[model samples]
Target: MKNLNVKNFRDIKGYVNHEGLVMKARMIYRGGPLNGLSEKEKKLIEKDLNIKYILDFRDEQEAQLMPDCSFDNIVYERIGALIGSFKHQGFDFGNLLQGKMTEDKLHFLLDYIKDGYKHMAFDNPAYHRLFVLLLKNDGGVYFHCSAGKDRTGVAAFLIMMALDMNEEDAIQEYLLSNEYLKESNDTLCEQLQIPFELRKNVNLYSMFKKSLLI
Candidate 1:
């Protein structure tokens, strides 16, 4: 999971099929919102990578809030996975640090994420749409959510699974979010002026990543 010059862009590398064949590099990518890219990065994506398809997993409101930039002749598909319903509820770090909320609300939050991931991969109609896109697009396909973590990770997991990648490899790919987005997350927490302890308590990406193991 190497971070790209383009923000939050990652190559879905180091995963292998059952036959021990590594997934092709530059064929499939996952990323955060592409709207903040510079002109050079835009050309790198369009001209060099020739990324032909994008599956945007962000909800309508989130998409409107930070819409992706237009790539020349690229097909942008909005396959909202209903992750918007999993909004952030305020966290109580004092209760959490004291082990009060851990068994209750913290577990509840993690359970919600697990269920959401399962739903997105198995039951959501967007899954079928994603399949269709995969069938139609031969070139590189990039999928993203708000932070390119949970929703995008689920999409990557499902795709790797379909391509015959084993459970461990798929999970590794999913967990790469922590490594790839470390800088972005740090900047985000600093920008929001969130306390370090509270940040750890409310880290949805970390919670969600851990939940996928079970």
Candidate 2:
């Protein structure tokens, strides 16, 4: 992965697909919220990566709360995935994290997230639009959500599957966010007053793995 200094940024490349061909680099990238991108990071991506398209999956409120910086020559589209209700409304992740952070609560969260992934894969109009944009884009495409851990991660998983990547590899790529976003996740856990041990036991990777398989 090229270190572009963008927070939680990663290139979805170099993996072998089901057809036994290596995935192309610099075509697509995924990462955390670009709303707070630094001037340098913005220049780096805009100039070096030549990213022409950005598919934002954040909801209207979230987008208004912390919108991505407007860059010259880049086209951005906001198509939030359907977690519930209307197609325009985004997933209620904050509400989902409410209640005791116990093992059982963890299971419930995973179950909800798994079903959400299924919705994004098959039912979400935003994801359908993303698939079309990816196929049509001439340059690199950058896609993300607020943390780029849950919603954006699910989108990445679906893209991998669409490209005919192996199931395990696709899952592993999705799980890579555990490492790439660990620092931010830890900070968030602390801010939420969640104990380190409890956070450690959440096992989001395994939860998502099982969810996709099921």
Candidate 3:
């Protein structure tokens, strides 16, 4: 992944690197690996940013789907969604496949993400400590979920804001996941036997991208 200290995200060349690390699909975008990151990339980022801690926002199923990224001596934590007792509600195999959740229900779930952030910002003091510990103490920290676009996107936005990066740039950074994620989305759609039109419905980049940060 390029450092992305530039603009014009619509054109991949607008980004520095020209390894064809760009995609026509405009939803999920990024520059990394799903199976395993290139050591060269990892080393470059680590050396550049002094990364030390890794926060993976994925659940067990996600870990099973894509092999976890393991660094030799770095601290890794899974601060996944605060689903709490309802954590299993969406992963009961047949349940999530149905996509039976109503729009209101989905909105409520999204609200859960928002509420969690509220707690971190105001209610939970420990959240601040942990966040600072990660950003300042850790050489490099990478937070990711199943798609690394939803939960991870939120964390990335927070970090970007903390780093004093502008809000628009933060949004672009979050959108980078769209590039690397569309192919994965296509693969998942095929596995679930999703039809064409229905697959489009599941792609929520347009409808939900603006909401992930909040």
| Each candidate structure's count of clashing pairs | 0, 0, 15
Q: Write the per-residue lDDT of candidate 1 for residues 1-214, one digit (tens) a residue.
A: 2224555678787677889888877778887888876788777777777678888887777888788989877889887776322534212222333433334655665666565554556666666777777777578888888878777777888898888989887877777777777887778657655566656755644665555545
- Report the error of model 1 at residue 21, Å: 2.5
TM-score of each: 0.77, 0.85, 0.56
Best by lDDT: 2
Task: State in Å the error of residue 43, model 2.
Answer: 1.8
Q: Whose lDDT is higher: candidate 1's or candidate 3's? A: 1
Ranking by lDDT: 2, 1, 3
The candidate scoring highest on TM-score is 2
Residues 71-116 of candidate 3 have per-residue lDDT tens digits of 6665666554534322534423335455544556455545544444
Tell me the spans in candidate 1 whose CA falls farther than 4 Å from its real position.
1-5, 83-108, 187-213
Q: Which ten residues in a row have the lowest lDDT in candidate 3?
A: 5-14
Q: How many times do residue backbones clash in model 3?
A: 15
For model 3, state the Cα shift of residue 210 in Å: 6.5
Cα TM-score of candidate 1:
0.77
